[model samples]
Target: MTTRYIDAGVNLTSSQFDDARDDIVMRAKQAGVDNMLLIGTNTQDSMHCLQLARHYGFVCTSGIHPHDAKSTQADYIAQLKTLFLHPEVVAVGECGLDFNRNFSPRSEQISVLSQQLELAEQNNLPVYLHERDAFDAMRAQLEQVKVHGVLHCFTGDKHALDFYLHYGLMIGITGWVCDERRGAQLQQLVPLIPDDRLLIETDAPYLLPRTLKPKPKSRRNEPAFVEAIVREVARLRGQSCEHVAKISHANFQRLFITRRGTQ
Candidate 1:
């Protein structure tokens, strides 16, 4: 039987997909990726993501990303709150710290992330977090609030992985795990994540798995290619692709769908 999969995160709103969104979704469906979670990096983008989710019958997130944190409007949280009222808007982020790039002032990133965490807590919605080279700060902020969500595109070390798992957030593994050099550390750490806490994502149009055979000419990753990430994850974890696909799908359901008390 074919192994079915759910792409835990996808950036369908990226301008690269402007002329090919329909084809992209269809190709993913054909590849056995039946569902996806569209990511929104800001309020306007979140609205666009919601529209795409509605159009495609997929779920999405709504929040400002750390890079864009400094530019957030005064009513950003209120805007996110309104977006959450829609069942399609299942999580409250793409928000977190990125000390690696320092695209936004660290202080502003922390402030914005704190407010979004509070918003997630208030609505009882899970978050779709992002962190990079700021694990200590992220951990400190997380301790101050009660929230649950996936640490999307995780690339931290064992200490960071251990803390997130213990804190009860899901671990989202992306195609970064497919890179032999940069992913070497992550490859070693993949098997450490417990089954229930694992999730697979493409983070499409970004981290395309280097393991893909006959690599696409455009080098553009999409939901369909998530299978490559899953296969790599399964291989590292000593499990079948089917097992990883099943548990990740279940994890996604629990974290996003089931928690909403909807079908």
Candidate 2:
């Protein structure tokens, strides 16, 4: 039998993904996916994320995107915490710092990240981190946070990978693995991440694996394409597709189970 999978990271706020609950669930169900984690990019997106998950019986995780770090505030943190109390709201981030875009000020980014990290710590929830071109600073902030979570779409080097794993963080690989141009290191690092500490996602509507179905009009990504990511992992690890399916599913469950009570 095909193993049930998980669409571990999806930005569901795009109009393309709006009102897509039934379609998303059906596609995942057809793919033997047991659950999907709809990641939110901000406060409004977070609430929409929860409503969608609860309405569709899917699991969800939400927080501010690092690019929006400058927008973070005390009231926002409090509001996010209130949302965290909801049964389907698992995990406290998509939070962390993003220097690649630096759409926001760096000092503000650090301040907001520190505050959000504290919220995750206090809430006793795992985080869904997003880091880009700021691994060292991100690592520093992460080190200070006691809560655990995934380094989503990890593009770091060996030292960074080892550091995250050592600190009890999982590695979330996305469709980038299928992009030879941007993901060469990931191809080499996939096998290095322990089976129990690795997960896959489409980070949909963004990093569509060139191998997946008909491309969406606006670079919109769907849940089904996650299969390509799984396939890449299978090839990189020299494991059968079924084995990759089972192991990754298990790893995903183990990591998220701690937050199951929230949902």
Per-candidate TM-score against the hidden true structure: 0.98, 0.93
Local accuracy of candidate 1 as per-residue lDDT tens digits, 40-157? 9999999999999999999999999999998999998889889988999999989999999999999999999999999888888899999999999999999999899999999999
* Model 1: per-residue Cα lDDT at residue 104: 95
The best candidate in terms of TM-score: 1
The Cα local distance difference test for each model comes to: 0.95, 0.81
lDDT, model 2, position 203:
88
lDDT of 2 by residue, 97-129 (tens): 888888988888888778878988877888888
**TM match of model 2 to true structure:** 0.93
Q: Which residues of candidate 2, in runs, are more than 4 Å off?
A: 19-21, 213-219
Task: Give every collision pair in model 2.
Answer: 87-262, 87-263, 205-221
Which regions of candidate 1 deviate over 4 angstroms? none
